[model samples]
Target: MAQLEQFTTPLDAVVSRMRALGAALPERDGVAVFNRVYLAVTEEVGRQLDAGRFPDPGAAITLDVRFAERYLSAVDAAAGGSRPPACWRPLFQFRRHPGVRPLQFALAGINAHIGHDLALAVVDACRSLGCEPAELEDEFDRVGDLLTTLEERIREDLMPGPDLLQIADPITHLLGAWSLERARDATWAAARALWALRRLPELAEEFTERLDAAVGLAGRMMLTPLPG
Candidate 1:
């Protein structure tokens, strides 16, 4: 394959990051870490969107939305007392960072974009399902409004900042504001988490095995109702 381009435009930035990650990962692993490399490349997609850098978007954008969906699942799992049940098709993996630190800003960035796409995805699906044309157009506009705000926030956050919002979300702030320290920390924390989650599908085989075991047990239990 051709070497990943050194990105100049914001659109290129996402692609370059993905290429960088593709190099970092081991070749033996399966689907689990596949998307992981992509996150490293696309970490800046939000920043680009915020800057009106969306250019020639394609399947990659939808794929990124899938990346966000995994974390939405993670957030849900976190809110509940259990990890969401693993599936071969579920596209993310758990990552154990070396230290406990706030990576919420990066998560916020990915989540923001994911949400932006999810709104669009709903409408896209509606259109695919033959929903009314005018209603679909309205939803498109609504989704556009949301994406506009999300992109703006991402851009603002990335700029250099002593601002409160940037401080509040250090991970994403650099898209608008450049901070060596925040970028470094994000490299370790936010960047790593996002990368790991993206490649989560690679862990599918192991997860599927574990899931099968759980299902087997559940099946046996179901064969005999609880005895008081």
Candidate 2:
């Protein structure tokens, strides 16, 4: 009970920071677009936690907080004029480009968070919980499931109207190639692989770096400019 109490403050702080970001950025700004989406999801997670939806509330909170911190840290880094992780560079770099649509911004942010930060966040949660990735599977699945639902809503809310969009739209093809479900699956694999290589610090570092770079490349592709 006391351990769980320890996480509550941090979780509240994270959500508060996200809310502030959502309030501060321009609604149409790429990072703000993603921030609004993420903020809604975070608030939902908080509600679920309050409703006792997670079997392991402590583990769930720990995972959720750690996962969010990674994204927030990247935001902080960029704000501080320091380099964020490679996976986050594209969205930050292209955030204000006139040609990138709101949908691209949202998905690119998701790609960086889920594809790169998530695997690392899982490991962070494990270390904090004194458990392995397997133990966190239930929490991970619940969060991932929530995100899958978010993905659907993002598409519904941000995507162009059907009348205005068609099979040949470049944005359609660009966003079509990336899937939140696939990213979740890969992140799980990466988390397990990272856990396995925990003893080999050098190798683990290299693996993480490569994963960061690969996810960043994908994010860059997703952010490819298109005519508005």
Candidate 3:
């Protein structure tokens, strides 16, 4: 209980920062679209933490904070005129383009965060807690479950209606190409691989780089501009 309380301040700080971004960005901006979705999800995670929903609160907090910090760091880098990782560049670069749909923005952000940042975050939590990926599996599953639910909600809320959607729509094809469940599964596998390769710094570095580039490619595809 005491340890859990210790995490409240930092967790609250992350939530506050996300809320500020949600409010500050324009509604139609791609970053803003995704920020709103992410902010709501963060708030829910915080609430779950307060309600004692996670089996291991400390692990959960560490994973949540580490996950959020990656997104925040990218935001800071863009604000400071520095380059964010390739996985994140597409979303930030195309954030304000009128041709991109809100659903694309939301999913692109999710792809960058989950497909890239999440695997890294699992490794981060493992290092922070001085444990292995196995030790954090419960926390990882819980967080992934939350994101899965949120991803469904985001699609429902942002996707065009059946009347607006078409079989030949580019967005439809893009949507068909990605799956949040698959991403979550892959991230778990990546985390386990990273933990196993912890002693092989060079190999692990190469694996991480490849993972980043592959995820960035998927994000770039997700951000493909439509014929609005």
Candidate 4:
């Protein structure tokens, strides 16, 4: 009960922050759109944690909080007019552009979160827990699965009605180029690689930078402005 309380306190705080952002920003604003989607996912994860869905409750809590902090940190950086990590720059930079669709904003946020944040979060959890990447694998997989399913729903809900959507649309093609499953897989690989290089701080930093830049490139592509 104490452990749950400890985790719930911080998790609840994060959710409250997201909720405030959702309420304050315009519905069509790209960051607001993505914030709503992410807040839903975060709330669901919190419920699962409370219901004892995770095998290692402590590890799960650690990873969940660490993962969320990365996103929240990006939000803080953007709000302060400071540069966030490369992986997150695109979403904030193009967030208000009328040409970018809501679905694009949601997916771009997921890309930055899963592709870059998750990998680093795994490392953070490992360091904090004094365990290993293997110890957190189950928690990672469970979280990834949730995000994977949510990605589908985000597409379905945000997609334009049949009259507005067509096979020839550029947004369709751009979205087709990215896959949450592939991104999750690559992130797992990156997590493992970072863990392996944990002893070499310099090498790990370089690897992380490359991963961030590559993911940012994908995000930039995903956010490509389209004709309204």
* lDDT winner, 3 or 4: 4
lDDT of 3 by residue, 85-170 (tens): 88999999999888899999999999999999999999998999999898888988888888889988887787776736556677
Candidate 2 local accuracy as lDDT? 0.91
Model 1 ranges off by over 4 Å: 1-74, 84-137, 157-228
Q: Candidate 3 has what TM-score? A: 0.93
What's the CA RMSD of model 1 in angstroms? 20.4
Q: Judge candidate 4 at residue 15 and give its lDDT.
A: 85
State the displacement of the C-alpha of residue 140, model 2, in Å, after optimal TM-score superposition: 0.4
Give the clash count for each candidate: 24, 0, 0, 0
Arrange candidates by TM-score, descending. 2, 4, 3, 1
Q: What digit string (tens of lDDT, one per residue) describes model 4 on residues 1-228? A: 555324346678888888988889989888888888889888998899889899898888789889889998998998898999999999999999989999999999999999999999999999999998988999999988999889988888877657365576777888998999899899999999999999999999999999999999999999999987
lDDT of each candidate versus the true structure: 0.37, 0.91, 0.88, 0.90
Q: Where's the lowest-lDDT run of ten residues in candidate 2? A: 1-10
Q: Which is the leading candidate under TM-score?
A: 2
Native-referenced Cα lDDT, model 4 = 0.90
Off by over 4 Å in 2: 1-8
Comparing candidate 2 with candidate 4, which one achieves the higher TM-score? 2
